[model samples]
Target: MELLRSLTIGQYVPRASPVHRLDPRTKVLATTALLVVVFLARDFAGLGLFALFLGACLLLAQIPLGFVLRGLRPIWFLLVLTLLLQVFFGGTSEGTVLWRLGPFAATREGLVQGLFVTARLVLLVVATSLLTFTTSPVELADGMERLLAPFRRVGVPAHELAMMMTIALRFIPTLVEETEKIMKAQMARGADLDTGGLVRRARALVPILVPLFVSAFRRADELALAMEARCYRGGEGRTRMKQLRYRRSDALAAAVVLAASFAVLLPGRFRW
Candidate 1:
């Protein structure tokens, strides 16, 4: 529960750093480019460089390393499962085996593949966290709406999609807090959530989940009513108070991101 509360995935951190001051469009584009580079990377050398770049970004953002990394704790199980699956099932029988457990074997090639894949997943999460950490929910929605505006020509509901995404992101922390409260209330009533097998513990969550779902629905209804009370409508004619504009800093940031992306691509292309 504490870990869930500590998650920085959808939460925004306010700071005076350059990254925070960057235009939301610039950050969105840079993050997308970085994700593309991460997927294109072919070897550990390229990944190492990308890691360094991401570390520098975090520093520039003035975000604490611990805060950014704590988000990984909730996903550690998935990461480990991915690595283990790759290590045991990724390589061919001809490859050198590093270890054996019954019929399953971990090969050197498999280890490399596992580490590379896991690194990609970790970097992807961290890169996205950087975007949410620096950009406010309103800015994120505006930027996403702008980025997707081109798709509107194809009859896509870009503004509505962006609004939905913004609401989801805004409510993630709220839901987590609500879940924590529900769990505590249950615990105070002698609900035994611990000291049980996986299935048993999952069953124990039924009581907590019931009220959680009820509360979530109630909150959603309240939110809808509140918006209606304010005479809210779709984004057809909506305008933002703080319009997004690209300044010199945004241009410089874009250039730097592009250059870094090119650097990451070069190694994979030329085998440097």
Candidate 2:
């Protein structure tokens, strides 16, 4: 589906922007901090400040606003569903009712809750997307492994986990491409993937899914063989080709994110 391809999550966009040039570890840490702030935000004022920060980050990254927003297309249904549930089923019974449908009522508190929840979800997605957008799969893996290295003393397989995550992210676009190919092939063979009710359309996907799964397995097997042939082993004693180093820019970026995090909390603290 075209919608699937529009998803920018886990897809790196090569650019000569400050955000992209920052150390991957900085981006990872910054993203995590912002995610925490998103959840901590309690009102529109807090969310608006964070939204402005996010917009600034997007601008610094040189990413088109429309491209960044297109990632939300596939999740529109989920967003709408969440809002509807919060509007009708949320809050106490004492709030002013704005609308009523049968026994369900939309209250003022419910509306505020719905909007806040929706904004949080959107901000979360955008923050995560920014991380993936700026960092390449290899860089992400290296950064993740380094970040988790301290836990190695506790017997955590940090390198292996990071490698698995890298492989998964790297294959997202590949899998999407393969799916598109299979869909086109099926259509060419007179297999209808559209023009049906929800159930029927889902049933129509069987033909495409079967071959896609087979292709996925075949690719995995080939990757395993290639790795084996190259004598690849677990991350024990592994050395990176390009070691990650934090620069002055990275420190500046981290400081900015920290300031923004504090700003996000201030609104809730002061109730302003």
Candidate 3:
């Protein structure tokens, strides 16, 4: 159950909205632009603007605030650890010491570093979460393939790579559900997944892994046979069912992303 629960990464929420309908290429590009700005943000003000942008995107995407925040819960411990490390180990020119206890010294710069670093992480996660929340795996793969199409000249199997990524993303939820079912069955047969030490808990995962692997291989074999029967070859000369095209909405979205990046970089630009 614990491992099953841990596999909750990249779960998509079903929603019918403009954000969901936008060209996946637009969403992917916008997310990438935002991520670049996030890393380029030099101060707290820029980071705060990044957070506001993320919140705005989440709202536009119609994803619940609770769901967006839920993803952060699992990483709370790591965030805390980073905060503590920054608070204690970060110092520029031995700035004003806030406190000293048992060979550990906390300074003003350290405090600033800790809070800003943590805030940056929060903003980054929220931004990326918006993309995953709005775009489906299939569309994302199509977008990726389109974006990487130029690499085909270099003998890169861009389409094949995209297909593999799409399949992996598609199976995450299915595998999670399967693991849950297996866990329930094992529990019915008197297996306590929680009550054990580290080694024992790891050993207990063997049963789950075996079934998961077996089912995965079975699925792969079935897929291969089906493809072969249909005369499917590699990504050569394959056409798309829904050809991705950039629309007015996608153009507007890209414009907004560009504006936001500029806003974060130069807040005084719009002052009149």
Top-scoring candidate (TM-score): 2
Itemize residue pairs with steric clashes in candidate 1: none
lDDT of 1 by residue, 92-208 (tens): 888899989999999998898999999999999999999999999989988989989999999989999998988888888888999899999998999999878999999999999
By summed lDDT, which 10 consecutive residues of candidate 3 come out lowest?
Answer: 1-10
Q: Report the Cα lDDT for residue 225, model 1.
A: 99
Misplaced by over 4 Å in model 3 are 1-9, 267-272
Q: Model 1, which residues run further than 4 Å from truth?
A: none
Model 3, position 6: C-alpha lDDT score:
49
lDDT of 3 by residue, 200-241 (tens): 999888877898899989988987898899998878888879
lDDT per residue (tens digit) for residues 87-169 in model 2: 98887898899989999999988888998899899999999999988888889889999999999999999988998998787
Better of 1 and 3 by lDDT: 1
**What C-alpha lDDT values do all the predictions have?**
0.91, 0.89, 0.83
Model 2 ranges with Cα > 4 A deviation: none
Worst 10 residues of 1 by lDDT: 1-10
RMSD per candidate (Å) reads 1.4, 1.3, 2.8
